[model samples]
Target: MTFSRVNAARGLTLAALLLAASGCGAKNTPADASRAEPDPLAKLQPAQDMAAYRAMSDLLYKLDQEAIQRELTETGQEKSTKPAKDKLFGFDATRAVHDRDFIASGEGKALADSLLTYQTPSGGWSKRTNMSTPRKPGQQFGTEKDYVPTFDNYATTTQFWVMANACNAHQDSRYCDSASRALSLILLAQYPNGGWPQSFPLRGKYHDDITFNDDAIANLLKVVGAAAEGDERLAFLSDGLKAQAKHSLVRALDMLVATQVEVDGEPTIWGAQHDDETLEPTSARAFEPVALATSESADLVLFLMTLKNPPENIRKAIDSANRWFEKHQIHGLRYRRGDELPALIPDDDADPLWARFYDIESDRPVFGDRDGQVYFELEKISAERRAGYGWYTERPYKALKEYRKWQQ
Candidate 1:
């Protein structure tokens, strides 16, 4: 059912308010508000975590800018790591672009410029390169996967909307031309049943399965809404995208609801990578559901509440999931996502095995595939995974422990 514009606007407002509460330093109630002193966060302006995020954004911006200027030589390469025409700028240079505070900074403009250059003749970018490079800090990661080529219609279509929006937000029109092309691509990619696949193969190879990838199409539809308001370039399909995103999200949400599992009273969401043929839910592959109260399940519920006009069912799910999280929160420098489990087989005198997933009602831990298999009985894993219980586990586990306290 389609929501009226007035109702949708109200829903969006409520969602924005919920999102604000989710950020950090939200007070519990107005009655408690009188006695409670304002948190430091409540008084301060929002700022990006400059040290880590800046360098990465800067590097990404510079690379994009160079690509836009046509300064690099293009060899029509098929691989992710194809060398640019110019001498490669060091990774440090790219990182420097992100050093600025705002996404609207000069570096951002440069990125918009670069993205503009890559739009294909068909109004979308083919897989010239992959954005993420899993490299050590200071190293430029390279991609070996060519999963998102222009020839792949769904991928290209989504990229077109993303690039267009990212560029438009920075007031750069260079990306406008590409955005128009992408609108054309979207019209071509839509399915008869109002679903979208990740790729569009021209040579009679049909690949259609709805998953998280479809979320990209949903987001693109919002962009198309903006395009239709006479922003030109890609204005043609703005109405189409808005309609499709609403239809697609509803379809996707139904599929997700059908896949949810309940353990005791708590609910868990499924991750992708289930058994395709049998449609069986697999272990935590990609955002797979876990029992309620565990950090995994609770966090999912918390995130879902931020959606505009969240359904009554979704609200109930979030409430149950969060109640479990609130009760089981570990308090201290050392904490686990949930209660720890005794190792089925001992590893050392002090080291006891633990499950990553926890049961809120039973007060037990849910082990993974490798939770008790004998190969690890004599073998040793890194301390990072065994953090909180181990003698020395500091980085993220410690940070997580601290954050949990704030949630309480």
Candidate 2:
């Protein structure tokens, strides 16, 4: 849904409040309320040691505050990364995403504390929120269910892994507690069938679908799979979290195999998104058609091959998709809608590539635009969308190369 003017106003208020709680605001709360205390986070910078961590965290929050304010007042300063129409919660302070800097400094601790404020009772956080700002005590924010957390833009999963890294480096109890809660939320948000919905405490839109767009589900697999195999950064994860993540990975693969699109009764590739209940390819945005998608499936196939001693079914699925990739490959064409004379000019040796979408029945490439119009030829799509969307990619080649090694 498009964020209306009214929602935009509401969103700014909530965004500012949450950003303050995440340690981004300029002013510090008085420790005892009556007496003034020195702000420990004044003029901080990114650091690895405890003393530097303190100052670094303060500085990080300060910068974060500036980014949030700029987003609120300026035009086109902070476009939503993974918009959910929640105005306030949907947008993030899209500034320099200094994950390493944030984690190393003392400000990182306050950042973790701020993360707790955003976490819903369900243990997950709202999707597409700025994580740098700290939450204030007794802070009241979010109109309606605007505060419910989700998995989009790698929300809960990202939080879990980052705090896990902090816990590993510093072994701080607060960070550990935060990471533990994130793990609990991760297990809670999972569907019984192993697929993860785009949002938890779902808002009942396409967000409820078992998502593959932007590599959402596959990213989850990598994190949990690493934890299962005992990645040292996340070695502190409880045995129970590891077991749950391992089992969750298995269940997710089942959905993956079940959701593979087949043309003429032969399994081929996958759709960018799928129905959570039916395991069928489903349309997401207006322009996102229900067809065999090469982008996300490329990531998924590579992930599947990472598993050791895969079941025969998975092996067959991988082989089938590779064949599909080989068959549908586009050649000798650049963006046909480019600003140049011939929108699509053929290069002598343009390497084999794939279209983002393909016709389910015809097996030919397809394109769509914000107008919800579908076109068979790239030149037929609108100029804006043709320029904006990635209709062509070499990402599939990464999977194809990995498959060669996996075969050996």
Clashes of 2: 19
- Compute each candidate's TM-score over C-alphas: 0.43, 0.70
Which consecutive 10 residues in model 1 have the weakest lDDT in total? 38-47
Reference-based TM-score, model 1? 0.43
Model 1, span 38-142: residue lDDT tens: 222121111122222222222223332333222212333333334221122212223323333333556554544444434432234444343322112111121
C-alpha root-mean-square deviation, each candidate: 18.0, 12.8
Q: How far is 245's C-alpha from truth in model 2 (Å)?
A: 1.5
Error of 2 at 89 (Å): 11
Superposed by TM-score, candidate 2 places the C-alpha of residue 167 at a distance from the truth, in angstroms, of 1.2
The best candidate in terms of lDDT: 2
**Which parts of model 1 are misplaced by more than 4 Å?**
1-106, 116-142, 146-166, 169-237, 264-266, 269-279, 284-299, 333-408
- Candidate 2 lDDT tens digits, 1-408: 355565455445434533443442223221111112222222111122323222322333344334334434433433323222343243232211236556666766555556655544234555545544543332221223433456666667766666676676577765665676566555545666677777654556687788888787877787767767676777777787777777767777787788898777999998888887788889877788888888788998998898866789899999999888877777777645456522556875766778889989888888887878888988888777777777877778889899999999
**TM-score leader:** 2
**Error in Å for residue 193 of model 1:** 10
